[model samples]
Target chain A: MPPKMNIEPEPGDQTPEVGAATDVAPLGRDHGKPAHELTAEEDADGTDWGRVAGESEFKGLLASKRRFIVPATIFFVAYYFALPVLVGYAPGLMDTRVLGVNLAYLFALSQFFMAWAVAALYVRAAGGWDETARRIIERLHSSRKEK
Target chain B: MSTPLLMFLIFVGITLVITYWAARRSTGSSAYFAAGRSIKGWQNGVAVAGDYMSAASFLGIAGIIAFQGYDGFMYSVGWLVAYLTVLLVVAEPLRNAGKYTMADVLAYRLSPRPVRAMASLSTLTVSTFYMIAQMVGAGALVSLLLKDSGVTYQAAVVGVGILMIVYVVFGGMLATTWVQIVKAILLMAGTILLSVLVLAHFGFSFGNFFDAIKHVTYHAAAGKVVTQDFLQPGLRYKPPYGALDLISLGMALLFGTAGLPHILVRFYTVPDAKTARTSVVWAMAIIGVFYILTTFLGFGAATIVGRDVISKNGGTNMSAPLLAQAMGGDIFFGFISAIAFATILAVVAGLTISASTSFAHDFWTNVIHRGTERAPGEEVKVARVTAFVVGGVAILIAIVLGPTANVAFLVALAFAVAASANLPVIVLSLFWRRFNTRGAVAGLGTGLLASIVLILLSPSIMTVDPPTVTGAARHLIQSPPLFPLENPGLLSIPLGFLGAFLGTLTGREPSAEARYTELVVRANTGLGAEKATTH
Candidate 1:
């Protein structure tokens, strides 16, 4: 048999009616007991006291996500804005050669590689912040059980 | 029968067989519409590549390179890079949020009615433009290949339309995916093989190839470049923009790939978010290899066959076919031609399916079935019917417009429409939490209207005459003509962004920040699976 579920339904919970009674009976038997036992013991010992600290820090991490967005927007705008003028008027300015390839071909190809690199960088940077927020949220949820 | 005709018959037979198989298995809407969400990651990944790379990549890029030289390769690079954006930001988020179409994601936070309605309109507009472009491309490909057979361009467009509609009406996504997979494989193999043969003929020396090109002095006035006379050249040919046009073309290539709708819909087929991410990586690899091979083919066409001989008839669309005939005999030429035809078919089918899904699922089923508790199977049936209707409409348009307009030009216009309308709404909805439903609707409407209005009033659309050497076409409408720009991406993309931002400021702010936060958390992490039973 599966473990019992201990999570109580909130007021006016809108769980689907189709398979509700039968499904909840198995879930209660499978998951309810261990979860309730764990919360009760933790509550007695005040084990999850750091939730307040975690919530404040999670808020700080969310603020940093805003910082990366501005620089990214600036880079994209400046890069794209120069395109039409360069294509229309400054073909001669790009006559210099890089390796066997001309500056024109080199710059064009590099833009693709650059876009990918920037996206990877954003993922790496933002991913760190997102992870921190997730951890903080997890910590708060556990602490709320103790309270 | 000629080699191209023989090969075309063979591929058409294979496509028909696959369609029959798909139709037999497609009992209900789920199987026909979303393939019952049972498609594996890698399979969907290849299908995505097939869907994304249309006649634009297979035929248009090579044609552009044959005419314009090194600048054309910039488009290939730009298109490949756009996938990175799709992989990182769009693929997983889209798959996680919506069960089927783009409307699900757009309206997830808002009321189903408004969200579905606006999303459907955006989808229809984007899809129609895209489908018209594909139809135009198909017509051009048929005309180019069958010009010697004494077939009119109108007949060719009608022929392709009939074939595509037959494919869609029978098989749906299953048929489309299989056709795309087969076509993509054939196209990659054909290009790769031709590139090898071209390089081998030139003694496999890159330095020698470049040296050979230096001797070729292209004559613009006579419409032929003199290749043999290096010591004493007859005429000097100079392209208008030396380098800057490279950057403009490159920017258009890069962002335009990300803005495509048929490509975006492929992400929804995967089973989970992680699968979507991995699928993107696979697509990038396949695309990178294919593009590198195209460079070899482009340079080979320039050096070996000589542009003068190829452009004897008209334009660069025939350059690759001519080069194939030169390097390899009639057999290889026929194979390449057949693959090109398949490329057109696969791309058109993908576009038709995406458009149909948007109409049936997003517009009718979601909007019309707003309060109803219809089964998922019923929705799929509606989508399949919508696909057939859309295909019929496209065929009619292609037949009607076959005489005067160039299909390639129409394809470019579609890209411009996609970039102007869809890109803004997608980007804002993901990043900007303040963007309300009213704001999204307004931005989409404005962006689409501006692009359409600009395209209609532009010199290219008005003159309808082929652009001449001296650029001597008079504008039909005299009033309110601001810039001579052909592409509306320069103006309309920003207009879309501004409209959305301004519209958001005027509307009431959504009170579902906490709900959005919870949804976002579920989407980003894999925790939603655990909570499925709770709902």
Candidate 2:
């Protein structure tokens, strides 16, 4: 039988409606194969996955990831698509000289820097997600000891 | 031997040594498929970049930009920015949830068999298409670069194919990853040196470089001398359907990159989600710089080597190597040729491993054997055989197609399939609670069929070739194009999403919906994520 999980909800973390169950067995053996290569017949990894997903911390993690990713995706896509659209449709504006090379060239050059900036920003944001994820894992470990 | 052939031999020697060492270590499925998930962030990042910046990006784009001007640079922008999708959407979750292939993530939430079958099929299809393009490009380019050494196109194709097969069949992912890292370093060194040399030729003045590009004098048709403005857009993509075509191409590169099976499989080699994320950042930095440097490589070739000379010597693909010769003479040319060859070899190895991994891990084990290897190390053995077969087939096709085929469309088709078939299902399975086995199967089938059919009808395949166009360069179908656009991404991607959404409404899989929470928890928090094996 699986161990009963008794995870303490952190401050602002929601209490899960369903209690953690002990139905699935722990996947103790590595068998040399990676996790995904293990038999599909196993229902779970002996963890109360539903209750863990219900925690506010996991919700916050998803929300935080979404908050950064959605906007960044939109911005980069817009910024990237603008290059081809403007170059193809508005040749005159793209041809206007700026500092020496044309606007089309400058606009295209800025994209490299733009990608770097977004990537750097996402890396910084991901650090916060990493911390949140760490706390959640700590709770899961603490809960597992309750059995 | 010529300098180019000698340099190529030296590269082959170094990579073979890597293969020998890796073969000893690759004893099991984990090592063969994911390199035991032991690769560090920066190393994996470099390897990812190496896997990505194929012969198309290095030779094809440079050639295009050298001749076509501002329009050709559009491809560079799309490719680098496309990494944003991989970073923001796919990489971390993939690393956390998947084992060896992209199908791992889907198999987590949906029914395993059908999804794995479809995903494996798509992976093989994409890999095969992309590999053939590189193989053909490698054959033609190697033959041209080493013509002085008496290497024919057939010899080059066969040599590249055999080397790639050896890498995957023996060394596995460890050798392939190391080879990519080595190639990435060499490629960067070569590109930077060439860029600096080009700048120095113009006395290191941006103004001088731009001034030269402003009025590039080239001999047009019938020996007519024309001074064209390389800074201006519309030289290559022009009129009628040009705008739509460029947009379609952009959509393909943008959405298609994250879905590429080879690139997706690289994340599995890293230890964790954070490492996957960091590696992508590293790749972005390297890839971004590399694409930006194409500016100098392309324009410098135009202003210095002259389009007339490049065309006469070999073709547009020779622009970079010929520019190297014009600037730093034959030694530099040979060095650049070696870098290009390394680029091709590394990418082909990457493709071979990913395709074979999908087949062995997804189809042979999960779909066929119900997720258990019948014997110890059977998966690895199967992957090795698949690699041999895949490499052999690529060689045969590249040879049959010969040197002058317009294979640029094949790469585009690969990207379109990835975007339409792979990306939609991946995104839906990850985020949507309602997505189930039926949805996934439908999405893959619809996306695969739509992209392939649209491409068949599109300008790329259906166009009428003029009388001057003959042999391999001639259009496959000699008729007017039924579909206006060259790339099928714009239409096929939406069709894939629609198929997935509608297919979900047709059936109720309560089991799949129940597993959604597990998938999300595992994906976002990395709980139960595969650990790196300690040797």
Candidate 3:
């Protein structure tokens, strides 16, 4: 058999400490603590995995994100499909005038307004979601430190 | 007395004022590169719109529509829809992850050195291709407007280059943003005015307008329908695409927007990932409307203006200018021309700034200056110099290439490069945890090399016969049977993914999952801000 190989850990690796810790030891002590006590300590230590995992605020924010995605996708895809059809099949439809512009021109221009409206809607809806998400993250972070 | 010149002067004056103000405000690197990250959400949204819309949108698409009929609209649709991909995949992640360039985001999880170097190289490549296209377009616009003024295309290019260099060197993002904002508004207004006039010509009757276009048809020439072919009494309307060209064009637009570096950097100007997403939604809305107007302008040019005029001087490319000349006269023509010039300047300025920032912040400061906390003032100085260097290089390339190359072809090459070099790395870095530094380097290198090689061998480059490569030899080697299709997206994008995957498998796994996870969380949730309060 060939000589045994040696593999060294990278300097950037801080994973050994975080990953290898099987039991929560008390602050300033070497003794292992109970799991429930560890949980409270984890929160107090401001690295609370439980709070981060259980945060409902993030769920709410994600829900809003999903809502925005669904509608925006519909509008954008519809517009994309509309292009070839309007040009190839409904040539006459585009030529019809609206506000001194043809239907095609009007629709193209309207797409911008629709985009702005969508943005405005996003801002109004997402503004709250972003703030709430920030709050939950902060709260969890603070909780982790206290333990 | 000419409205065009007056409008042009007015815009120049406004831009100058903004530049001076920006110069005063920009004290260090952060201010020059990213507006000190204090720019409001909505303002950045408008600036994003300004940066994203280029001469291609203002002139190329409209001109294409006027010349090629529906095919032009296909380009417009492709351009706009690609933004959705940007919104979904790139914007928020990009904004949240890194401080400056797209490379910053890609290299965040890895060692800074190699990642920054590679990312800068990609930025330079993409920026150079994109800048050349913009310059070429600018030259064309100048030539069209000043054909009778004794101004050469070279002079036009140089003049625009000077304007762009000055804008970025002195004013930074402030100058870039203000010019873009003003230009965006003017472009929209000009198109809106032209649409109104076109409608008025038809007595505001949409039915009559459609009837006019329905009767219009062009004879097929060289397998491509020449719009002028239809002007005569007997010609028939030949559609621009049969099937193949449509797919080729659609794929180009779809992947192209996702890859553009200048546009991607705009997301960083916003406050957070959420704002970046919102800004994209705004950019999409603005861009969507602009494209729709272009379609009308194109059809109006085709129907109202005689094809004989447009075809005589450069065919479809001159359709919009000719239409402007017809409807608005010398003054109106000058006004539109000036706006077009401003459009080029604004875009080139933004591109130069983004490219330079990638070099300075991502490469020089982050990668090269690793282990050193970059002085605030020094970072800005490096970026400014990089801007000058990038701008100078672009000018040299533009001069070498001259004004003979097609603007659309250059733009397509830019798209191809962006898709190949940047997109694969960006996508993998976000989704694949297995993607390591080696994987990123390989993917970037492979994608870039493959795309460049494909483009060189493709019809565009091969068709240009040189003494070194005889016509017969060129033809023999011109079409590679392996990748019969010229577009690299269908080939290179996959290669990028494959290269990245292989690199990951061969490389060592990242040893710092906890820290990496923490960084990702910090990037995603702005968790680092809490640390700031504690400190």
In terms of lDDT, model 1 sits at: 0.65
DockQ of each: 0.12, 0.41, 0.10
Q: Residue B228: error of model 3 in Å?
A: 9.0
As for lDDT, the candidate ahead, 1 or 2, is: 2
**Which should have the higher TM-score, number 2 or number 3?**
2
Q: Write the per-residue lDDT of candidate 1 for residues A30-131, one digit (tens) a residue.
A: 332333233213322332322332356644664565577567656754554454345435555554555654565556556556655666666567557556
As for lDDT, the candidate ahead, 1 or 3, is: 3
Identify the leading candidate in terms of DockQ: 2
Of the candidates shown, which would achieve the greatest TM-score relative to the real structure?
2
User: iRMS value of model 2?
Assistant: 2.9
Q: Is candidate 2 or candidate 3 better by lDDT?
A: 2
* TM-score of chain B in each prediction: 0.88, 0.99, 0.89
- Model 2 ranges with Cα > 4 A deviation: A1-44
lDDT of 2: 0.92
Error of 1 at B164 (Å): 2.0
lDDT of 3 by residue, B101-135 (tens): 88877766766688778878877887877888898
Q: Model 3 over residues A1-147: C-alpha lDDT tens digits?
A: 898643444457564454334675322332333223343224234444334534666556556666776777677657655654554455566566555445655464554555456556655766776677678765765454455
**Interface RMSD values for all candidates:** 9.3, 2.9, 7.8
lDDT of each: 0.65, 0.92, 0.68
